[model samples]
Target: MTNPYKSYLSIGEKLDKSKFILATFHLQSENQPPARNASASDAGGFDQTAGGVAAESSVGTWTDVSLQEKILWENLRGRVVELDEKASIIRIAYPLELFEPGNIPQFLSSIAGNVFGLSEVSALRLMDIELPEVYVRSFPGPFLGIDGIRKITGISDRPFLGSIIKPKLGLSAQEHIAASMEVYDSGIDLVKDDENLTSQTFNNFYTRVDEGTKRMKEAGYLKEGRQKIYAYNITASYEEMLKRAEYVVDRGGNCLMMDVLTAGFASVCGIRNRNFGKIIHAHRAMHAAFTRSKQYGISMLVIAKLARLAGVDSLHTGLLPAVFTRDTCLTW
Candidate 1:
């Protein structure tokens, strides 16, 4: 009638097992931290920044262990209990002997998703406790992914042609609205304000959303019956973001955009989780710092999947070969 974990522990104790492997995960940020390059020569990987790779080191038995929970778990076994409430994290441990010496990487890989429902740090700690090959590859992408986007844009035969309302400098709401008209008329399906050009001087967000979307709708009606959505970027404190979103909805705007990087994961997820009808476009302005690394940081794929889970209707995966930017080969 005892717990399965308890049963596993009793067996380990009866056999005099000294080392138990623990996996801990740290969920400090609602969004995935950006990735950064860290030379392998350094012991602490990439100094764990907001959007940087975590430092990897051996802990336990070795007093200088970069992570100590591993060692503690080795001694505690089933005696240890864990919990993860929210933005915090959780950690889980197993008998180190449960894994093969050269297979720590596989073990972490197999349990990364589960990890006894622990924190990201807890997962990392497990690997630190008993080194893994560090295969941070995330889940298989979206289901109704690029094809779905193509179908929505009615551009399944080609990439979704889009552009931004440039001149991130001084521009009145009227002027911006004029630009939206041109972009839509010229055949662009999507148009967004520059990340820096939020509801600011001269071009207030409300004025811009009201007038700009009005112009976009006008253009769609006159052009080819296609509404080039002006996804007003609603990046702000949650309350303000929600207010803006509601405002956009009230104004007949069907698409909403948020700089997921700037707004934070909880904000994006909060909006998406609401299941709003707007197409959630993710603008990846500050993502370069995390995804630019070829060696250390996490991949954009992880971010994309998380966004999808958060409920983003669409996202800027990256430029394609058909465009000027390099074909990063992200989500279609």
Candidate 2:
């Protein structure tokens, strides 16, 4: 009996770095004995499970394909470039043509989506991904990057201090303003809406922007001419986010905070591309659900990279750092 998806395994294939993405996954197999129907030479545990990942993620189904389908699969399937048995790591080289350029959501949906649910592996994590230079540059990253943030706050050579308006909820819009003003008066440089506080009746979105922005201006101008950032949360439906952003700009707010995970990457990109002259701050509120486990789901580093590609200026800490680069592997 021949292996059904053996063609997906190409152990020593040399990929064009520019035309492919290298993804590293921490893989685990059920490690059971070979089925009775398998060939006598079958090492039907880890190798087959690893190959299943490439097949499912790319083009192959569990069932065998016809000769005609094999011709089409030749160029489309993700090729397993390296598999380490002891360390339980598999590296796959995926063709750039397999992904939609400049679309993070679709790219993730393809490689990181369906493969996680497969029964062959009990534990899996999307440990790391290396991007081609062209793919990295395809999206407009960071509307107001580090220099812009430094320029905004008039701070150099030191970290800017900030806080959230706590008693995170049940604070009326006016009370929320008072609490934020206290933080600003104490010389904190940034204040943001907590991730869960958005558009609630007790603290309505419009009032928060209208009054909060006014108070920020007073606090900023009066306190040694320092600029205070009101990173107002605009996480909502895409259309609603735009509407809220307009309201923030109209109210003279200098920054916007988004629960990027909750807002969705596409919406984050939508807000960034609008370029309403405000810095975008990312809050990964529910990221732990996807990032905490060392053996499951996507890594926080991957999330940060996606956030940067989606155009966030500053991100929540655990947490927060710039995207992974070639030098990053050295540090890891």
Q: What's the true lDDT of residue 4 in model 2?
A: 61
**lDDT of the candidates, in the order given:** 0.52, 0.81
Worst 10 residues of 1 by lDDT: 49-58
lDDT of each residue in 77-182, candidate 2, tens digit only: 8888999979989998888888887898998897799999877778889888899989989887997788888877788889888787778899999999898888
Candidate 1 stretches with Cα past 4 Å from truth are 1-156, 221-225, 320-332
Mind giving the per-residue lDDT tens digits that candidate 1 earns over 1-332? 21122212121123322444443334342332222242333212111211111111211121133554655644434322233435333334444544444332344344333332322232222212322222212221233355555554566566567787778658899998787777777877778777777777888889988887666566553233244567788888899999898898888786678998788766775676565556778887776554554332334665565566555667876555564234244531
Q: What TM-score number comes out for model 1?
A: 0.56
What are the TM-scores, per candidate, against the unseen true structure? 0.56, 0.90
lDDT of candidate 2 at residue 311, scale 0 to 100: 94
Best by TM-score: 2
Query: After aligning candidate 2 to the native by TM-score, how far in Å is the CA of 31 from where it should be?
Result: 3.5
